[model samples]
Target: MRQRVVVRHSPVHGRGVFALKALEAGERILEYKGELIAWKVAVRQHRKQGVSGHTWFFGLTDGRVIDGGQRGNSARWLNHSCEANCEAIEIDDRVFIHALAAIAPGEELFLDYQLITDEPADDEIRLGYACRCGAPGCRGTMLAASDS
Candidate 1:
């Protein structure tokens, strides 16, 4: 099979994953590989990083998270889009990126980063995790609309 994707600079955010060839809907793209860490540890590391911008922690269903910042693959560069073309599926402690719709060659792959937060989404919180996907219906923040 040909190289299906590549990581490059993205207009949506910083770096992002882009499809190198046409992809069919429902196609399993790539696994989001990283260091498995507890949620608390992930939080601690994220805070320690002291970066105000992006993050690479992907939550898993089993209460742990994949710290993509360490030992991560190209999938970690995938950015968020309100009108996403891809979806992240967590299965058995692993997360995979899947095409949600037909994707054309050279198209940037996107996933709805419906990030959940324990606190209410106030202005300060929303500002911290602002969205720049530029989708028509962009929610303005990567944070989920409501606390989860």
Candidate 2:
């Protein structure tokens, strides 16, 4: 079967998923796949690896997180955008990426990573998650708006 998405260098960040063909709004694109792990383990792994700033941890409603860096797919390349053309939907413990609006071929897919944080989003923390999406209404941070 032909692939629907491709991972490539992104001006927004390190890598990004791009549409290979025109996708209509509401189209189911890809599943955000990864190894299931506890938050503590994920944190410990991140610290041990000395990784900070951008991460590919997708939190599930069940209190577990998908450590995309462990066994992620092209969907893990999806970047964050304030005016995103796609969105992530959680179903059962898996997350799916769906188009929020019509997308053209070669367009980079984006999700509004509304990442919630455990601590207050002070300037220091906020800067750590700073948004480089350059969306018209970019919120400047990847954390949830409430945190900003």
Candidate 3:
């Protein structure tokens, strides 16, 4: 079977995954594969690497995280968008990026990285994690609204 997507330079961000063919809503696009690690380990590795801005660490339902930077696939290229066309579904400790809406050929796939944090959404935190999705209602930051 032909590949359903391709990775290329993205106007939204760095590299982005685009549809090679029309995709129907609810179609399972691809798996977010990577090295599975404990949440603490992922945190330590991220800190040790001094990585910022972009990240490939996807959180799992069980508190573990997928370090996509290690052994990730094309799924790691998906960019964040406030108006997203895809959604990441975690099932049985695995993550699948599924189409949230019908996507046409050459359209870039996006996932709403509703990244949650325990810290307060202060000015410093917001500026550090600023977003440039350019969506109509973009919240200006990738960090999810603080629950506290």
Candidate 4:
């Protein structure tokens, strides 16, 4: 079945993506798009303001890559939270987000936005204008993955 991320009314981070069905552990959520660039190229691309800006690309020494740079799909719409409900682990050239705990039928799914980078957060980076995820240990700021 075509998986879809649904946004539900939340008390903490406004609306956020939730899985429509039970997603197995290590399930593939979506694959990132756009051309794969070298690490330096990706960094320079981040500096430029071009449309379709480069995403964090990965290439192993054996000429393989697992790029999940957020061009589109529900992965882009997914939000950040300190107490994220899910975690994405890279395996066999694919990025997968699985439930750390059993997510209920309608619970909003979350993954910590700041996990892999030192991305700064302001009003603009906040997805959907505001956050209301109501996750326990919720930080007041949207996209603030941690209070520390």
lDDT of 1 by residue, 49-114 (tens): 554756787777565778888899888888878889998998888898889999999999998877
lDDT of 4 by residue, 21-42 (tens): 7765555555433344454444
lDDT of 2 at 49: 53
TM-score of 2: 0.84
Model 4 ranges off by over 4 Å: 7-15, 23-70, 116-148
Per-residue error for 10 in candidate 2, Å, reads: 1.2
Candidates' lDDT values, in order? 0.80, 0.80, 0.80, 0.50
- The collision pairs in model 3 are none
Tell me the lDDT of model 4 at 11.
49
Estimate TM-scores for all models.
0.85, 0.84, 0.84, 0.49
